[model samples]
Target: MSPSQPEVVAARPLTGPRESQDQEGAIPPATTRPEQRAQARDIVRLFQCRLCSFPLRDPVTLPCGRSICKQCLPESHLRLHISYPAVPERLQGFQCPFADCGREHAVGDCGLDVVLSKTTELVKDNLARGKAEAARIKMSTRIAVRDEWEIAGIPSLRSPSPTSEILTGGRLVAAWSMAENGQLDFDAEVVYHGMDGESDDGNFAEFEQEALHQVQEVARTEMDCQICYALFFDPLTTPCGHTFCRSCLHRILDHSLYCPICRRKLAMNPLLNRIACPANERLDLIIETFWKEELHARQGILEAEEIGRHESLDVPLFVCTLSFPMVPTFLHIFEPRYRLMIRRAVEGNRMFGMVLPKRAHFSSDREFHELGTLLRIVNVQYYPDGRSLIETMGVSRFRVVEHGMLDGYTIGKTDRIDDISLEEEEALEAREVTPATSPQSEFTTSEHGSPDLATQTQAPLALENQEDIARIPTKQLLEYALDFVARMRANSVPWLTQRMLELYGECPDDPTIFPWWLASMLPVRELEKYKLLETSSVRERLKICCRWIMEWEQSRW
Candidate 1:
């Protein structure tokens, strides 16, 4: 890995360091033991309570630069909708008394552990809620087995159709992402549930209520922008129902209609700052309770298994990943469990599996990507507030053979892949590979080798066809792969951008040139990345990668 690589950079590249200097605590030192030690010490400082003389024992650092114990930051423990770190004799709750800044950090030495618990809880709560709702839909409320109340092919029944239906998400609470206005919004997602082709809107007021309640908690600290990694005070949400710090998200929206996370169409109002919306409060309450219960049950299973017998451990349940070159999980505050994940990856094997969410139930439907990288954990550091800074290097690419939702997380059967050739590797080593980066070169790379495929309009092209495109060699199918990236846009390209440059030396601002310290970023989808993870033969893997890139690019572009 290149020690010179930027820790977090956007596609357009980040113009500045985001977050309080407290976050700078996550940067790890150079590989040397002494430097790493110094960096670790510096990182540890970020976890200390800046306001108090003590270290943030059970660190829950608020956006207001205060840290508190998790017990002190209970969800409904607030006396008023405000945050005050110093618990006063008159104060009944841990809520920060500050007006707009109401939430103080939840304190606890599980400090890092607590944050991980929070994230895992986020997933768990969602999955459990989904299951409960499924049970509701499964139950025949009126002597009919109907997850859907609307009758198909008949106009008689007034039916409420769901706007979206995921087979199994832990809790499946109403997915009210932070929108342009308010904290969340609601929509009627409908899906066909029974053989009768009947569908119904699954919008529940209770679910919306759950969202609002959580927002009250989430609002206390505010969120760091997903893009710039800054505290999201007065955050702006997109039409796609995704939120980001206003300035960070707008930069992308201004250029094109794409979600910064998945590059999908954000059908949202650009002007919305905070949307006041409704949720099914009653259902949300019931479902939220069930979700917590289920997570505890699952955690119990893991604990009991550890004490009794070792089950088939190789079967990877959750496919966590840190991709090379891109920081998709940017500004994501490090939680404890994830911190544990980083520790294991660093100490045990420096390896972790890259898995994809099922195509149907992912955060976005466009997320069941065709390719992805089995990124190796490269860097890990703890911020003073106990959040972690982590880096993973891309080692292999993967393809999804099949995908489905298991328990509540997305699951898939995957195979590993490689797409670079001996010659291309030599070229990359020589730093001789070039990009048709200009609009003219971009078009030329696409049309030069094709006899009848000319006059096709193009998108803003990044990266290059590392191969000599004038000829499509029979043995080197990877050439077809390079051609694939030439025409990709939105979310259709397969994984392996940095690798393409590494083997062929055709990357932008080429980092892996000649004697440089490291390779550039390798971009791929979760499945493609998973495939690379599963593959053993490097040569055959390249062929598989080439085929996937071509297929994905061909489909979208």
Candidate 2:
């Protein structure tokens, strides 16, 4: 009641502890106090709805025994499309909202928590009573202070809201809410002075601003992509705990299939790799919470870069051999850069260019022949040491228009090549002529149409834009090519022949393309194969292959 003294209210005493014991057959025979049990129950009640952070309502327990608000569960749109049996399978991938308890839960794993529901009702009762008591006390204090301030010529200040007041002090003293003689009291000591300093509202705004600044700083630093040295755009965290922007990780993986920061091998099959590392859902959530603007900006940059990458679509090149259309090529990839190249190729359209080396060089950007074959992957077998043996077949030939290096591998802008065909008149005229004294024409014909014999309707095809072309019968061309392959002395020739026989069945129908298959199976030198590959016309390619086989036959002497 002193004019110069601040108001004080008597403080409430805490509840006395009552000893308790667990059930007789309990596993641990644990001892607890009533106060301690109550405190534990209160702690559980304070846990907010995992999705919305409001007090949990209509509690639903997960398989992990943690409860969340039923309304907080994701919408069951999946049930609309999924079969009843498949519902469990589909929900098996649903992530628990609780941090560090990120265990997946199936729809079958969730049910109403009856015990929690009862506990929630008790908690609601307690909260209601506490709020009502606090409001009554606050109203009484306001009336008493208003009258006292008017009598003492002191200005009356409005009290802060229940939430703010509790956040500042009531919450700190909440443990002292025990009742004595059916009454709760609060005690305080204060120094009062005329209001001449910064208001509490201004101080609160400054504190909020500082907290936001701190959060933004931490988010930017933690979510930065190590490869690009920028905020993560479409961030992906490797199994090794390192995160990077999806595009940056791809660029790094283009050179090495390892974590760019730790250099640890990423656990992935080179033949079945992905665009980036596995996603970190927890980190993604954190980034979205604190750095949404940065994430949006990063997405914009990534979208622009994606458009740029496609503007001039570049095909990765393997400077190894002359792959022809429809011919299977098996590659043993061991080099780090090539392993990355194969990984990316397998992940993407499963296509790449196979070219002969211009010279005996591996790392040089311009070391590959201008003209190459585009190959489509068929299967891949991985080894323990991150190496891979991939099986692919040539799709079409291509001429490298613009070549460059990305990371360490060769990439080229290419134009696909197609075999040239003659005009209808020229084709008919050329078909009338047959070669004399050619090895292909020497096959003896039989009534049963044996593999060695030429068909009666078969004829040579005249290629467009070529002169002085030697003509060979289509059936004879296949016979000669198979014959040339059978004469090869290499150990791999038999297997190659078997594969070829299995695929084309001893001979391919298209005479223009048959020579390339023959060329692929032959034990000819790389240079010879490259020369044969460069030939545009079927007749010219056949003549060159025939002369090479003849020379090889003579050299065998």
Candidate 3:
């Protein structure tokens, strides 16, 4: 390739660097192809496999700067971790499993064939812009310094009348039980000076002071939630040193009974009276710390609102599941968090990013993705049952790098991603490939001569010979299956609608239990699903589906 001519680059018109910042994770839409991989460096920013010298096939890149074919990765590790049954995400780091590569490294994961095609001119344009940015940063600067702080003693309590002066203090004894039932029972008592107080405010105030005041001594004990948010009443400490409430565990497990924190097997047996609650000393410290933290959070916001007297209280945080290309691609794989996410997205334009957790150890700490789609809640329907169905459409896609976890939701720093095309339909002419007259004959030419794909055929389908079927691309095959599934399942039977959709994109006209047939051939492990989830472009999905279908057929006969 010829080097970029500096004069030509310099002369080009400029759009500001801010305009060019990446707004989405690197993944091309379904339109990209391999032939472009060699020449489309300007358009594609995705990671390529280090071993095969391949550019973004099933693109799996890790933060450590290596790439691998997501297809080749194990289903457990091969697919995007988001749909891998625990926490969900589109791309995740994969280890280089290259034969005898002999290196312990990870590549930041991304989708292959997911980016838009750009020309050499675009690359040169971006490079020139980048050079200008670097020059600007170097030309301008700022000084940095460490922040200072001051620690202070607690303020005196505002008690009414000093009353109960029982035993001044004793060790605060506390015991907690994790019983056979879900309740986390706790018994806390403080051994303090003689205590006698009336129920009236005067006495209640004094007693409250003595009960809550600066406990003469309390150890600072804090437990980090393995998932997001502050600890609740019933936190379960895991063997892997992670702590999450039973609800959080249930949330992550999706009822599979696995630990959400570490993706490890959980103990089915219940814990009985697991440990002693923080002693009186520890309890006081925790309460005080919590109070301080809560106050700190509300301080600035409340002060402003109090002065303005016109702030709305709808402090909703973005909480949804799928993000970006991943969202539309995996619409059928119904996992709980994401199901809730999509439902919530449909509630309005305000949607949040679903950031992949930086560390599984602290996934539950209000952790969330930054810059997400403004999921407009387009439809909401409810019946006699308590649950409601929500439908949403993406307003804008965003990339959130420094994501911040919010209580009860996910929020992140986002840059909006522009869509080249929305849910626009590409019309296909009425070729009329129906079961009755659509070319459903065997090929005189040995099956497998479609230009884009070549499947090894052990048994040729009579329909394979049909002239029209012989010319279609892999993408068209999916569209056909999708259309067929929708037509097939137009009626009853919702038992495994999601499963069927995952297989063929929709319920078919015949309502046949075809997923079982499909699953019988493709790899049925969790990891296989992960690979399917990791796929970005429609073409990649088609390729994987084609390979798996062939594998399935080969496995049988």
Candidate 4:
């Protein structure tokens, strides 16, 4: 069958004296027969290690003018030789392993042969890439054959035999050329010939079964995952050259930094550096092209998972500090993982959770607080660098139900929390009131005094309960609250009052919403404000905030 063409790159020449350098074990010119002489330009032979007779790996040169593979030398031979243990050691030397060059040389005097090492590395990398490409081509062909047969209403095909016999000549070669040039050209025409006349139609079922068996054998070798032993979904490759499903790899990495199959050290750093693990792009492309049915099944499962995540309130979470409802939170996002998180947030609901970071000593899953606020993106300003300054406002409170990690950031399923209401009791109490004595008329002018009287209007808003606050006219309550706030040290933080005036404007008209404005403006601890946030009653929130303002007013004396 036609195969993809290999790339051609000009090889760099060795800088040493090429004319003098020969194969390490080459016979002397005086003893060599005329026909046994080496070629004029055989650089590969000249750089071959003297000990292993192969391309050098980490080459080191001996003082005796010979080079060998570092790994090829015995471990014991790497150390300096000491003749007597009692004597103080002043000299360190190495013994050459070559038969004709069994000489002792100073250990520290030897150096790495950089030119030889580089040349060998180039040769080895090319050989490795060639092998990988060949395997990829073979696997791709099997996948293509199976996919086409299934599509054509035939589940039976020989292991690559049907493929080769159908497209054996110029058309197959042209397809290969197109593929090598970065085009997917698998639509080559195939001619069908009727079954041989000698064979009866009765035996077709048995023949078909045999062909199906062969197809399964080839498919099992290529389609099954090395880790899960099932069809691959979201396959990824490790630096150690082993492939596994993305989820399987993530689970394995949670315990260790080694490949599951080879047990090779897959990473030099911690498992948190998962970004270093790269996608197996070639393998992924092959599967997508050839396994449409399997991919559809995988999609079905993923869609179900997405439905479940939504039920659990699973959105991306940002762990940093406390945020409260109706307050603006500014964020400086620069981390690559958070950049991806922000992009997803902006694309989806434009919402994410903001939770405070937990202590380092806690478990990874416990790295954030249970309580968090959901923030809605207001605007984002991008900088020349990839970093961004995002403006957001807190929308609601939520408690995490389940936590999961996506890519490098945190995500969680959460249940939204709302303020507990006094509506049931208030409605029952309102229904019990008599229609004869109206609620407003019962509050005589004597208790509330005249609207213009400073003595009645300037009373502390903190002492008023929900009913008492509601009894006073809105104009009188607003004036009295403003006078009390102006008399206290609450405005000591100038920006607090300035920001409140800028955002909500002077004295909100709605009594129920005024508490939130006052809470946002008060210079209080986040924990205390969070308590106010958790409180369900607007009147209760106002009482708590006013109490704190009065306390601050007393402290000023």
Supply the TM-score for candidate 1: 0.23
lDDT of 4 by residue, 116-221 (tens): 3553455444434433543443322111212345335463542333332221112122222223333322232221112222223333223323332332334335
Per-residue accuracy of model 1 over 276-367 as CA lDDT, tens digit each: 21121211222233244643564475468554533323212234442432222222425555555555556776655454445467554635
Superior by TM-score: candidate 2 or candidate 3: 2
| Model 4 bad stretches (over 4 Å) | 1-307, 310-313, 358-361, 425-492, 497-512
All predictions: root-mean-square deviation over Cα? 29.9, 23.9, 29.9, 31.5
In candidate 2, what are the lDDT values of residues 334-374, reduced to their tens digit? 99999999899889989899888776355545777788988
Model 3 lowest lDDT segment of ten: 1-10
TM-score against native, each model: 0.23, 0.36, 0.25, 0.36
Model 3: residues with Cα > 4 Å off, grouped in runs: 1-359, 362-374, 381-389, 394-398, 415-472, 475-536, 548-557
Model 3: per-residue lDDT, tens digit, 1-557? 11110000111122333112121211222121222211212112222233433332443332222334456453333221111111122122333364533222212212321111111123223333433533443321111110111002221332222122221111110000111111211111111121122233243333323322322111112333446554322444433334454445544542334656456554322211222111112212233333446434544544574555323322233443443321221233144444465555555543433333323456354444333444444355654543555544433344554443344344444443432110000111112223244332222222222111123222222223335442343334454544433443564335236674563443332211222233322334533433433432333344454444444345632
Please list all clashing residue pairs in model 4, or write none if there are none.
none
Better of 2 and 3 by lDDT: 2
lDDT of 2: 0.49
